[model samples]
Target: MSSTATAAPAKKRGSGLFQGLQKVGRSLQLPIAVLPAAGILLRLGQPDVFGPKGLGWDKVASVFATAGGAVFDNLPMLFCIGVAIGFAKKADGSTALAALVGFLVYSNVLKAFPVTDAVVNTTANKGVDVAATYNNPGVLGGIIMGLLAAVLWQKYHRTKLVDWLGFFNGRRLVPIIMAFVGTVMGVFFGLIWEPIGEGISNFGEWMTGLGAAGAGLFGLINRALIPVGMHQFVNTVSWFQLGDFKDATGAVVHGDLNRFFAGDPTAGQFMSGFFPIMMFGLPAAAIAIAHAARPERRKAVMGMMVSLALTSFVTGVTEPIEFSFMFIAPVLYAIHAVLTALSMAITWALGVHAGFTFSAGFIDYALNWNLATKPWLIIPIGLVFAAIYYTLFRFAITKFNLTTPGREPEEEIEDITKA
Candidate 1:
């Protein structure tokens, strides 16, 4: 008559973390994927390419330019959509709409008064302007607004209000609250715009001033931060968060080093360094993976590798490929990190000035080329990097017996599946 001990119920895995990660991945997918196509269009529309009597392909070029230009120009809208869906509990339409409301409020409030005009009229010569708040509704800003809307929706979506406002309570209340909240944020942004912008610009200059070594550091850190999704924070500090430098007349000017590279293209310096790594290095790495695979698996691996490589090279969507080998061959991953650092250093040394709205892919290269000071050099530089990547990866795989692709044991694969 001994009492049998009941085994504790198997602990259920938290679906929240997984679901959240999926949403973020999904949110980023479309925007990141679309960048390369945009880059190509931008390249086609360059004055040299599409100008009058320049090329017979003007019509074809125009189409690419229009499509890419649309995405590049409306980054804020894209961010809003991405953030809303990424943060929503159910990925519903209401969340997306709420995000739009937040964006609209922030935009309108910021636009109502131009900062420069206000500064001129004010007694304080150094006072910040209001227009700066609306100037660049970047990815970070979109995320913030989206999160605000999501939180509001989650908290009040089911709450009942007084009879007079009952109809407007719950789901309908989200947009209303979102707009009001955005307006409040607009006021705060307007007040601090100048100081925030200046601080960010100074930081960008400091990083840029470090030259090749700085680029290497940036590359290593960027990759390290990818797994947790906090790379966005670094992005904001380097790109969108920084304020634009200005000339003596107070007109916005490019930072010295950045101007020397891409001129006044997009927003940041760190983004430019990625062009070499993404367009050339990653694809080469993919080739090495295919080459290292067993003969029987080569065709299948090649197909997958080609698709993933194309996406990385063309658009800068690298997660699928990076994740492939990251878990299986961490030593190889470390090598990849070092190689990435070297690529950034090399690009900096060459004075190549390509930048990207997305990843360092061909599409971004194409889009940003015209805007870049020496866009033609990007391809040549990237090609060189590609060669280096191939040699290094191939050698490392064979010499070290790195478990890259075909090296994984059947039992290990089975265990991974079971887990």
Candidate 2:
């Protein structure tokens, strides 16, 4: 074939794949978006709606629970399918089939060996073994498998083979190769998985031991890391780095210490600290900015302030609020950080266990509250944080003439965008 003709096919395939991936990404968005809201609703609305003798409540609750459960349960499957299709050259049904093949191999390998049993034998302990084999197949693993399968499919989907294996060559060969790859991956994971998991668990326990100081540090680091994508890595350490809890029967139970604080028994030591900062403290800071604004720019500043406060309080998206003053007045940002630490300390001291999956906004608060132990205490603590935020912010802005919002000198206003 001529060079142009050969390249044309490749170019066409690449373009087609890109379009397909976009469609797949869009399709996945709806399902992914629903996950958080469904989680919140099921958690918050469950008791009231499913309580004894409630009106049509049981059915409504059951439906939401079932739908949400399916999505939560099948996240790995979704990632495999979504990513395979997303990365494939043709974005065909075959790509999805290859993904399934890879997923099955990866999942089964993790499930095959009981890590807890191995540990038990090594320790010779009659005591309960807290470690389990494997937790749920995560998004990272699924995406890796998907990409591997897509590559295999693209590479060998049309290759010929020897007589006996000839039938398996081409598209049919992708899955067979994936199975072998999965086996190799399984062996690799088996070797290092235990030590890695333990190391992570120890790290988390250490962080938890840091108590209020740790919480403050986490908040500060979390904020700083958001501009980059490293936050997800940090989150993994905080969230799923631990192995499953093992029961007396040697069966691995599906729960982690992190979840204990944020999932059930909801008074997670680390998570509760964010409630005050997100729900109350940030809003108070916004108000202070408004108060500090130049009289002429008060209306403009007020508009920005209101938007920031609402987003912070209702949705827990602090970037808009933080960015508003972060660059212009870094001292104020430092104060915000200090106040966050203080809030964490106060909440920790007061024994509040509030946790949120999204931001520390009211929506997540409402969703997680019902599932949390002593959920009602969050309100009182948050109110206190609000008072603290308002007082400190007002004092600092006035005392320093910090160029917050409207208080920026006219010359500085032109440079605000640059900052």
Candidate 3:
């Protein structure tokens, strides 16, 4: 009967969803944190930066390559631990430990059982080989195990066992349950992952086939999904070995980034487009944010803008600028996405072939410059996008009076929260 009664449930639901996102974000934070180091290491080891592939810096590159690859190769393990810790109510590390155990078991199970035509075949899919050895599901599987282990921890951390099994109680029981669940998940993956892998391969093929157009489309979809945090799934699928790649040494690499690292001849199509956007476009957007701020807050906004701009340029972290206007000016966000797609398409068409361990940024661009087909092209492309971003974002913010970051009214608080 009351307005409060009608609105209270809705408010609770909203808060509940926000909290869930916070948890997921926390889980991803640690695993994502390691990427910068991994990227830097991989870049350091690449012979292109030092000399020619056959004779240049083999010893130096080998050391860093192995060190860096360790992180990328073990991303699933990191994801499992991070997500488990993230989802835990207590966040006491118990869930993380359990998740690690479960993920290991699950990965081993997949390895042991492998794949079969009977298990993987879909009548419609003909090109994919069913007998091919599949890599462990990696981060995808890690996220699943982490979530499951978190549940086991939540239920059994305080659980009391029967008289005969009194020792297997509370924290002790968490691992017990996860061990079985992990093995079951492994079997489940064995049965289903190949078909799913084939599907992802097809998707990657379709994107590559579209060339610049597909890159633009991919850019748009990636940005669209950011609000829900599901963007990571799409990103991982594209960045990792989802499609097949046989390197020069006869090593089959999977995913765009992985293939690039493995010396796959195909080139980094999905990855080439982002360099301009992350290293230049987002920074330009940051500048526009500062310029759009009211005169009174211009100093503060500029300070914020400078920091975020530097971050975007160096590390490809664009959230500080993205979140500032994503909600207030959905139209501008739409435009941003479209422009991002265009950048990807354009650069891709120009035959750029660089890949990054973390994101499209100065570190990856500069360090792997020699590895690319035309690394010099990235600089001009970046400059063009920077100018484009500044012009478009500045005009939109002022013309529409969009409330971005420091431009928000005093009474309206921007929620910096994200998952």
lDDT of each: 0.67, 0.66, 0.79
Displacement of residue 206 (Cα, Å) in model 3 is: 1.9
TM-score to native of every candidate shown:
0.74, 0.68, 0.83
lDDT (10s digit) by residue, model 1, range 1-419: 44797777875697666656545545554444554565556566655677444575767766755675676556666667666766667657777787788888886777765654433434464554533423443555666677677678778777788999888877888888888998997776766666666666677677777878877888888777666665654554454444355433344533322232223533334655677778778888899988998776688889999998999988788888888878777766787788788777776666665666556677666655556656676678778878988888888888887777766667876797799
Tens digit of per-residue lDDT, candidate 3, span 64-120: 877888887788888788878877787686777788889888888887664432335
Our tally of clashes for model 1 stands at: 6
lDDT for position 156 in model 3? 78
| Model 3, TM vs. native | 0.83
- After superposition, the stretches of candidate 1 with alpha carbons farther than 4 Å from their true spots are 1-46, 52-74, 111-114, 118-139, 236-239, 243-268, 294-303, 366-370, 375-380, 410-419
Predicted candidate 1, C-alpha RMSD = 5.9
Off by over 4 Å in 2: 1-34, 44-48, 51-60, 75-101, 116-181, 242-263, 398-402, 407-419
Rank ordering of all candidates by lDDT, starting from the highest? 3, 1, 2
Off by over 4 Å in 3: 1-26, 49-57, 115-135, 248-251, 405-419
TM-score-better candidate, 2 vs 3: 3
lDDT score of residue 325 within candidate 1: 78
- On the 0 to 100 scale, the lDDT of residue 323 in model 3 is 89
